[model samples]
Target: MQKLKSKANAKANANVKNSAITTNKRLYTERQKSHFLVHSVACLGTEVHLAACPLEFNKGNSSTGACEDGMPAVVSCVAGPLYTHNVALKKKLKVSKNVRLKGGTHTAEGRVEVMRGGKWGTVCDDRWNLQSASVVCRELGFGSAKEALTGARMGQGVGPIHMNEVQCTGQERSIWSCHYKNITEEDCMHTEDASVRCNTPYMGYEKTVRIGGGRSRYEGRVEVLQALPNGTQRWGLLCGDGWSTKEAMVVCRQLGLGYANHGLKETWYWDSSNVTDMVWSGVKCTGSEMSLTQCQRHKVFNCQKAVARFSAGVICSETASDLVLNATLVQQSVYIEDRPLHMLYCAAEEDCLSKTAAQANWPYGHRRLLRFSSQIHNVGRADFRPKLGRHSWVWHACHGHYHSMDIFTHYDILSVNGTKMAEGHKASFCLEDSECQEGISKRYECANFGEQGITVGCWDLYRHDIDCQWIDITDVKPGNYILQVVINPNQEVSEMDYTNNAMKCSCKYDGHRIWVHNCHIGDAFSDEVERKFEKYPGQFNNQIMN
Candidate 1:
């Protein structure tokens, strides 16, 4: 009986030991799966769903179902201490056009409006001051707030009072990042809407550069304030020689204007200021320099033409447009077309036909047209809107769209050496969405007086079959040549990168048929590729033909 009891006790102990082993394995598996989920959630931030994290059961078990149990596996996650901060780092706050200033004459001044939940609202002036206002100005890409006006000095804003008692260190990227009190019923009203006048470079550094004796603020004689060796400041004219867009850009930048459209060498009509002492001469700039003092200059006490009429001038713009061509599309879309001369009236009017057509023998002959499609894109952050207001857009009865700009894109057939042989261009292109990527919708259309512009992430396509989409190559001899397309040729708008605005293609035309190859973005390729592209195999022509 004693031996039987010992065996019974030993059997009982063995059974308990087996159960303990199974429980321990299951616990180990659960712990591993939980750890994996937590790691995935931490890496991917709040966008990850806990259940979606990858896991495996019985992964290291010898048998397929060794870790299987009647109970289901469960995991509970407690966000780690670093989880909140990690999530914030993973997500970026989008800066929208929700915050805007209104009621001021210029874009840099106005009453403040904060867009909240799809509704525009106002900010109370309770604690609105220069620091808080500076945050708004900087967010809009301007300098800082010059004056924080109270009592709706610019004008009253409507809608909900979104914030009050706002505070800022004047360095926040957006107003939403600044601390502010949520609006309450007793907090404020539209009459207390905050207003601000941003501190533009024009107002702060007026002594540095100034425009005078022109019809508008945009056009004027350029004058610089020079500090004499004796510490006295004197305003004088800039010598017109070597004055070009590069020097004008520095002046516009110093004045807070967007860009320089034209740098006038002789502002005879704008010489109303009559301050004829030429102090700055041979002013040369690389277009990226910040101010006139930073540019290379020759100080001169006298000039041969020391008259205010010969002073340099600039036409400043609030913004400049950028146009870029799709070289890939141009390469694949080349063809030859012959249209009747009578049907080329509009093309002739716009100078899209060859120079021979402009002679007295004009519409009597048909010309061989080198036709191709053009895909113009505006990759700048801002929309490439027309410089003129709606009133100035010309009505084009042929294209059934209003022409906003007189010169938009230039098409030129050049010699291998750069001499222009044949030229054609599109005037007043109707900006619209030819196509867009996923999640982007077309904003501008040419129909029914619709707003015209290439919105961000949109493109404008001029098909090869469209009228005037050709270079009149009828009189050209067959040879190797270069095809160049320039957008925004007049620099009517501002762009982040003007270097990428042109595209080129290598062409071999035998009079009857043309072969276009080796097309590329103007500034996209490396130096090695460019050298290889311009290289000739057997013979090289040093002479340029036009």
Candidate 2:
């Protein structure tokens, strides 16, 4: 028994030594090149960018190579654990590229969705073939397409249906360059959208990363298997110092999760996992990276709060809600109403009308109000909830309603040159589920302080008769104008996409009557098609205005 125990101990020591050698080799290998290039200079103390660094690449001053090859003459300000906190507070995150694949259990396969003209939409499967599918897969960094599916095999997508009848020859680098047939209303539908399964290389990223303790598979405390200097592996906790949506995005992509819904800085509730070792800290992602290993990290564990309760965490989801205003209703609801000042005490108190309304006689002079109805539709896979909780809600005594958000929508009238002619009044909403689709029960109600949110397949209708729902246009001279209404314009809430939130209409208003036409969502048409909009026969000389 003593001889057997001695042999087992020797084998374990050998395994640790082998792993240590591999780690040393990785310091100078191509793996390190992927994370960073040994530039002559990195971050400077006061300078936010490396370009402003005093070091130059010219001549004998610099020796550039891997970490083990040579030491840099100028030390990077972000080099060691001492400066990780500074970088966390100073490093600016890059804007996220607006693209995602949805309805799949894994990241490498899904119904292809693209963001063009500010909205997320699916590709039509009309001519969907392997050639086109391969381009999409290659663009996502997966090698190629294993299978190209048609007729919404992965499930249908919401918002505008895009990229119909794609024609590719299999060598194109990106799906954007491929030829596609322009879709018509009767030609295609979301039910006939395209989906693909990509030929992804088995990376085995799941072996190193895991969600520590959570109720669901999609959410938990983030823990990673870290290698010790002696080359043994143990599950370690992540510091919550700078974790955010961008870092969560990389984690989700690495785990084959669909998308990141939230990034939790402190996860005390999910601390059920007994991991107390803080092995990673100051993970700064550029919002475009596909994995956490690709991001910048501290050389040592440098956490301000090393408690396990302060570990980084993430909540992921397969889908997000997409909101769109009913453009047809907005156009059809256009009419002029001369509202009496005597009956607008609630409106005046709430600051719903124009600023000039305050100077006018209270019971005499009326204001010309441009009335329109806005129906915000949630067409995506998840319900749309307010960013703040019930405690932050403000109650308006005059309207007798609670405003969940300060400004839910933006209504404006712009000229053909994109100049604002008349600014529309902002309406803070109580946000109730006015109605829902078949088999979908309402989750929010305005009565008795019910929960506030716009459930999926439901809409919150702001009728024309409601207070603070009209535009004060008494001083405006009517001509050719663009009516633009943007839902969630301030982006106070999270959603699947924000580009399709804007709806535009062409309005021709004379002295007596008004005409609103050509209304459509912002992403409804091509740029070329939209450029030809609201163009009167000879409007450059103001013939229509006269």
Which regions of candidate 2 are displaced past 4 Å?
1-132, 135-142, 146-192, 197-257, 263-314, 417-419, 425-430, 437-441, 531-546
Summarize candidate 1's per-residue lDDT along 1-546 as a digit string, tens digits. 999999999999999999999988988776554222122122232111235346444444243354432333455533222122365542442233768775453456777888665446779999888878878877765666778888866544433688899988655778999999997777787668898987553334445888888888887988899888998999888888878877887787777676676688899886476577778888889776556877988754545677778889998776544456778889899988777788888777767787777773555768889999988876443567776766899887765667788988888888866788898888765778888756778988877888888876578999998877888997789898888888877656555445667777788888889888666666443444445455541122322100
Task: Report the number of the highest-TM-score candidate.
Answer: 2
Instruction: Count the clashes in each prediction.
Output: 4, 0
The digit string of per-residue lDDT tens for model 2 on 1-546 reads 999999999999999999999976865464434223434465433332345556534334333343445432333222222112355543442212444565554555777888676456778898787768877766665545778888765555655776788988666666777898777768887768788987665656677888868779889988888877898989988899988876776787678776677778888887476788788999988545556777899986799998888989988877766677888898788898999999899888877777788899889989888899988888666788876788888888877888888888877878888887776666555787898877889998878987898898788999998887877777778688888889887655545555678887877778667778777777654454456664541132222111
Pairs clashing within candidate 1: 320-493, 320-494, 321-493, 321-494
Taken over the whole model, the C-alpha lDDT of each candidate is: 0.71, 0.73
**TM value for model 2:** 0.57
> What's the TM for model 1?
0.51
After TM-score superposition, what is the CA distance of residue 445 in candidate 2 from its true location, in Å?
A: 3.5
Candidate 2 backbone collisions, by pair: none
In candidate 2 the C-alpha lDDT for residue 290 amounts to 50
